[model samples]
Target: MARNFIRETLAKENETFLRRMEIPNKDSWSPENGPTSVRRHPFCSSLKMFLVALSFAYFSKALSGSYMKSTITQLERRFDIPSYLIGVIDGSFEIGNLLVIAFVSYFGAKLHRPKIIALGCLLMSLGTFLIALPHFIIGRYKFETSVRSSANSTNNLTLCPTSVLVGNHSSTLSSTGCENESRLSMWIYVLLGNILRGIGETPVQPLGISYIDDHALEDNAAFYIGCVQTISVIGPVFGYLLGSLCAKIYVDIGFVNMESISITPGDARWVGAWWLGYLIAGLITLISAVPFWFFPKSLPVPEGRLAKCSPERTSFIKDSPGLDHKYQADEQFSFVRLAKEFLPTLRSLLGNPVYVLYLCVTVIQFNSLIGMVTYKPKYIEQHYGQSASKANFLMGVINIPAVALGMFSGGVLMKKLKLSIMGAAKFALGTSLLGYFLSLFFFAMGCENAKVAGITVSYEGMESLSHQNSTLFVKCNAHCECSKTEWDPVCGENGLTYVSPCLAGCRMSRGSGVDTVFEQCNCVAGGNLTAYVGHCRHRESCQRVFPYFLALCVITSFIISLGGTPGYMLLIRCIRPQLKSLALGFHTLTTRTLAGIPAPIYFGAIIDTACLKWGHKKCGGKGACRIYNTTAYRIAYLGLTLGLRTASFFLCALGLVVLQRHIKRQENGTLSNGNTGHTVAELQALRKEETHNSHSDQSPRTSDYDPERETRL
Candidate 1:
């Protein structure tokens, strides 16, 4: 009875307040008058259409990004670049974003958003196409091999020479110089293209999300964003699947004869048809831009909702300490004036303890996320002894779909429960903590190191080899004169990988291509043992572990993704509606600069340290790592990932505490203002409008917390 009396009193006072403010009453407004008065093309103005367009934009960009990650190893091999160099190329995308994201976020919000997104999509397409440019411009790929087999030669190939061949050093130098120059050129093009892609992607997330939240039914905003994110996750699935398919094909397929190729897809030296996927992805991105061109700069607020701010001007600015800037909708645009307000606006955003703490958690977590995702496929290939094609296939068909489902489920959970900011923080924190604990299991899932003579195990299999005294020379192969740098591995019957058939002291070889078999291997423990092309297959125990590792990955992916939507909501909800775009942009800027740009580079450099075998470049010098110390690799990768996540949870707890205090302060402030009547009245007005529009959609719960009201803090 007391609650009813207070509600009725607030309702009456809200009616009077509405009339005094001259805000249109529900009966006075329709599709034909006031804010919803502007006539629009039905298809172009519908929120559904905008959602579809934005989702596709998300899909296109995600596809490109994932495709880039999926091709990391291929790129490393193709350019003969080290992992650290590849890391730089990978980070170039973030570098591009850092260049333009701030301006695009703050100013682009005031301009035609859809058109700007269209422009961004076009740039992304161009960039995708540019990444593939090297394949066309560069000559046919010349893979390094110690073997010099020819179809016209005798069936049995000769053994290694008794003495090492001393070729013209100057000619070798010139050839290496030319090869390095070519490699440098290819990677530079990739770097620039990726940066362009990053720049192009800057406006898509902030602008599209802010636009949707602004026009969407407030209750449905999280669901819509979730749908977009869910669809976007599908992009990576296709991207990696495309990568899987391409990885099986020879990189120079059309230009090179299949019969002449000696390497199989599983060979460490193999370069896949990585450029083909880029062409297909670029075309898709170009098409995604079309719908954006037709979308309007703004859409009408859903029928039942009023503007997020009050008629007297939002309290976010007036209530904020040291923040005194205001821009009216009718005010003329001024670059200099807006520029002057940028710092103040930024200060206002940073001043929020909740936002700052939230940013800290996200930034720390992203470092681990980016590094892990970027190197996961590589890890699978190296650690589990799986081929690149197989690794990509598993990730595409298994892990990505789980993430998509989790994101969608997160949205559904939010809507069904009507989670407030505090609820969201709790939910996100719970999911993340659970995922982190589950991921600790990965460290135990590592496979034993590949048994390579003079590397992991001794040539005789009688002792372990240490890194300090590692040498390819042994009594059995002392006369073979093998090149230590060569990485054309052959599997001995004794279950060991030799750097090359020459290093295995094979006297002769038969057949050609992948079918080649070296005979009379003197280095084998027993006399006249045979060896086959390609590295030895992984142990049965390792094979069994790989599937279990992948299964755990799928589960962990789903659990981590379950927090994605709520966490995103927490970000937007904590900021004032007017500053949503700038806040999101700044958030992205911080993450890209601190996380995306450095994570991959440092991770790559660290991973490089575990390299047991480095592939030789055509001219010499260290190239991409072919094999890793699996124990060290696993420990390093999982340790860093979990370490960062562990650190973030500390901040997550702090952020939640800060958020609770902020909410309590706002609650007290609402009661003390004597305008609690105005706040309740606004809610009453919105509720009455929702009641009238009940047939159009499910009504939002009256008790659901309004983030806009909390904006005053």
Candidate 2:
């Protein structure tokens, strides 16, 4: 009887275990099953989606801009529009974006984020289509003109102006008139197109950032934002490539050669070729809209029930509620209130020494980068005598490695060193600035020495060396040694035929009584005037100027890149998870507001002024004129460098102070102090809890426990 009782009890225990297992745990299950699993995590998948969307939008926008960039100068020439005015027109898109971002960010928290993103995408597509209309008309006109020109040439005698006879009037009809009509149509279309593009792009910046903010965790917000920035950087490169390809196609199709019987100069051909590239760019923008349709319509958030009381009302409750309460409270927080709250938070942040210091550093770094982007090409073209396209290509190529290494190495170094996020930021900013400075130095040195000798010493000058000169010119030829007759015979006889006369003459004349003549020649070659005692004063000035300029470039690059890293890192690290997205949005907003709107236009004005003063003949005026003629660019660079440096200095100081203050506060036990060593572990635990709650659809009534206050002594 006892053995039978034991078996029945064991069976009852087994049944209880099976029943518990069979009951579904709703908390752990995702709302959407299958492929959506990959996208369920807001911390990862939503951020990735936002990045991809931004990448597409930015790429298309930049490409459209590139097309305009390549063609705008030609348009100015054809239509007699001021280049600066064209620049303003070009900047309209950025202006629109700025306005849109400000409005969206202010109101974004209240709106359905997916709907906002969709609206942005729709606008972008519509704008792209509108922008393309002008180019398309222009393209068609050119095509028609080419056909007509071919027909006219084939029947030259019958189509002659003096000839009264024509076999078929339709066949002999002038297509040039149609081409003109198309050109007129293009002018009208371009204005409407730009307006549409501006409107489309307006909501993009804020909406995209807000979406990411809505979805991503605070700790990882910076990383995701960085990814967004990385994707953004790619836009310009793609735009350039696409524009170039379009231009090439136009050239191949003979659309660029549809001119009257008058002989077209090579420069004119080049101008036409460039314009054709722009037209192609617009078409590409129009085509980019096709991809938007495939974008996911909406993203799912974590499932949870709303709290009984609003977050404002919950302030009456002294004790912190459970996870469920906090979740509901967060959900009920009004976006407007959040935006208003941001101002105070920002002000507090600004007031904090550490935060201020970081901000200063970041501003400097950003400004330096912007300055480099704006003027580096011009510097190369002017100081190095490189073509604009070549200069742009080189700048882009060099940056690929530099930026990649900077970002990756900066992150690694930060992690390895266990630097505070702010510290890591500062270090990165400093390093990048240093790198920029070095690059600038090299660039400047290259520019100065490019023509000093036959040998190319700088990137700008090195590029000037043709294949013909590379083989024919000896190393000694660079020092103008071939012109020194006195030591040429001796050097050549000694198997040092390429040696400079200054060196050989100095060595040979040293032993002889003819030192004075050789010394005079050497002085002349070195830019020293030994003719008079005081004349040597000018020599030092000449020798030092270029080196100083090069040094400035180094300093500027270093300061900018260095200062920028800290703020960028801070944005990644310190902000609360829920607030990080908004912080990042603000960061982007500031950058775009300050830099994006003015940079291109400012550079364009510089180019125009330079061209007008220097004469187009020397700087390819009939085409896009280079900004090499004036010191305005340098002045601008200097101003930016100084501003950034000042800001960095302040930010660094602020950060240090804030950090020190926080340390003091912790030591004094004025605030709840958690074990610093266990911060990471606690964060991980919190994340796990959040994950559990999200999947289970648990209520927000979980008890509130402060990890910092719960540590065992």
Candidate 3:
């Protein structure tokens, strides 16, 4: 009787194990079968569904991030802060990423990845809403200008009145004072919000990409990543287009009377509705989280798609004896066990020479890409003489679409050519080199600096103002009692910009708002003593050069984007499959901490040195720059971008050398192993099983083959 009881216990244990391992057929799955039922749901089980959901998540994050970049200038002006200060705000996002990426990428990968991703998306949504909070909390934007009082009021009768004409022009200056009496730096809110955004965005890329790579067919992984990346770029197009639209609208559109506002969107003082886009982006991100919650942590490999792991793609280091314990049911996980493994795992990851070198290359390259992209819109406005709206529109409508197409094409080429790891590295290197060459032409395409009298040129327009002790109080405007603090610029007919109508020695003004024209200006050189209410238009040659520059930019963007997928594939394939998530996380952490955070700050600091005209804050300090020395700005901007790219190229060459040697070693090991008949027979058997499984109607599920598949590879 005791023997029979033992047999029954053994039989029951065997039955339970089989039940735990079984993958339910479609007809057997139902809503009543507990939590596993959710995983078995048709839509939730599909790789395609996950792909679509992941793509939208990528799009939502990219849209918000790019929108922040698009509004850099507007933020600078609105906050009454310098460019360097604004750069700090831009870097805050990276700071947020630095805080959580390591833990999320490593530990989170072991949990319900989709649920963790959902939580992250919710955090991102909150952060985006926070970014928009300042606009609503702060009083309406009040741009710094000399003509603060109404144009219809008698106080505006003498915009450039001399002390003799109006007792003192200082008296004519509006005394409403700064609306921000407390001198609060409202941009602090934006900084905090951006940091939160960074934290939230941390999981989306590394986790999402690694998840897709983990589940999809090996051959189709690159294409899936490509589709996600391509779709993500489309988000930027919408983001920049949204930026352009917001830039055209006044910052205080519904709150203020349109007729009272003197500045046009072209003015340096103009602050667009930069806050609106964040709200829209936040809503979209929130919606993206909902789909993820229903998705299973893992999915079955697509039907009829055999597993294909290239020999070189195998891990250089052997797996730990019982590392598989970490991937078991969530209830079985132990904090002590994970903690002990963390350092060793990290050391193993860093020990790989290829991964280390790739990090170096990517860090330097991202430094260049981030800095250039952050300021490209500002560069267009400052260098090419395009309005903020126009610059954003061009990037949205022209540049981004090319990038999307190139990313998709790169994936298609990878699949079609069946590029080996080395071939992919070579392909990426070639495209990067070609793109670097194409980018060199941008150095020659800059327009001449705006001829601001007493700033860039003397009042007589004979020569540039001396750099030392340069002052706006020239002989022509000496009689006028201009404050010298205000930056309300006006353009003279002689193709020169006056710092303000008051500084231009203008004694009268006509219409109200943006249409107001200052007449009888004493400083104007020609007989026509009239100055318009804006900066001077660029010369025809400069205008023609802009189109050519844009055309080159589009081509270069496409070429550079062609390398993205191949490079990303290299990053994943070089490491052990077990380390993919952690490697990605560490890479992101390193790039964001070393590259993303500092590039903008340092780049902005350098760019600040090129400022020709700095605006004033009523609270008393240097504010946003009104104009830049186009020559200096162009050199500083393009020089940094190209110099970094050049450094990365050298690094890339070294990495390829290391990778080639490693590949040879892997090939040699495989060849030696293949000579053994037993090993050859085992590989043949595994391949046969894979083929049969793919072709057979009654094949076992993908999970059933994982161990054997890894052994075969």
Candidate ranking under lDDT, highest first, comes to 1, 3, 2
Error of 3 at 67 (Å): 0.9
What local lDDT does model 2 show for residue 266?
13
Q: Where is model 3 more than 4 Å wrong at Cα?
A: 1-53, 106-115, 146-156, 164-180, 205-227, 291-338, 526-528, 672-713
In candidate 2, which residue ranges exceed 4 Å CA deviation?
1-83, 106-118, 128-199, 202-233, 244-253, 256-269, 272-350, 356-365, 439-566, 572-582, 606-609, 612-713
Give all TM-scores, in the order shown.
Answer: 0.82, 0.54, 0.81
Question: What are the runs in model 1 whose C-alpha is more than 4 Å off?
Answer: 1-52, 106-112, 147-152, 166-184, 209-227, 291-330, 333-338, 418-420, 573-581, 664-713
Q: How far is each candidate from the true structure, as Cα RMSD in Å? A: 9.6, 17.9, 9.1
Candidate 2 lDDT by residue in tens digits, 1-713: 23544445544443332222221222332334312333444524544755776666666666565455544534443333445556566656666676666676666545555555556656655655565444444433221111122322321221112222431342344343433443342444455556566666665556666556544555556676777767666666655454434433333245444343211211121223444544455455445444444444434432221123234322322122224443346445545556667787676445545444544455555555554455554454455443345444543444433554455555565667778754665575466446544544442343222122222211122344332343323432234322211111111221121113332222111111111112222222332212110001112333455446544543443343433444466765654454466566666667666655565566556455534112121111233331232244445444454555556655655665676565465444422334454343345555565665565465544454333222210
Ranking by TM-score: 1, 3, 2
- Candidate 1: what lDDT? 0.80
Tens digits of per-residue lDDT, candidate 3, 1-713, equal: 23554455554443332233232332432223422433445632477888899899999999998899899999999887887888899999889988887778777877788888888899999999998998888887876554444656543576755557554434344334544365557888899999999889888887888788766666788889978977887899999998999999988889998887888887788889898888899999999999999887766433222113222211211111222333344225445656777898899899999999999999999999989989999999988777899999999999888887787788789989999999999999999999999999998897877788888888877788745645799776777777777788888888888888878888777777777777887789943488888888856778989889999999999999999889999998897777887898788778988898899998999999998778877666888888888999999999999999999989899999999998777666557656533333344555666565565447656555553233333
State the displacement of the C-alpha of residue 322, model 2, in Å, after optimal TM-score superposition: 20
lDDT of model 1 at residue 272? 95
How does residue 469 of candidate 3 score in lDDT? 47
Question: lDDT tens digits, residues 1-713, model 1?
Answer: 23554555554445433332233434334433333333333422478988998999999999899899999999999887888889999999989988998788778987999999999999999999999999998778877554445555543565665744433453466486676555455888899999999999999998998888766766888789868867887889988999999999999988766766778887888999999999999999999999999876766534344444454332221222221132332134346656777898889889889899989999999999999999999999888887889989988999888988898899889989999999999999999999998998898887887788888888987777767767899888888766677788889999998888878889887776667778889887664999888888857888898889988999999999999999999999887676787788678779989999999999999889888888766666778888888898998888888999999988988888889998787666667655564443354444554554463356555555343232222
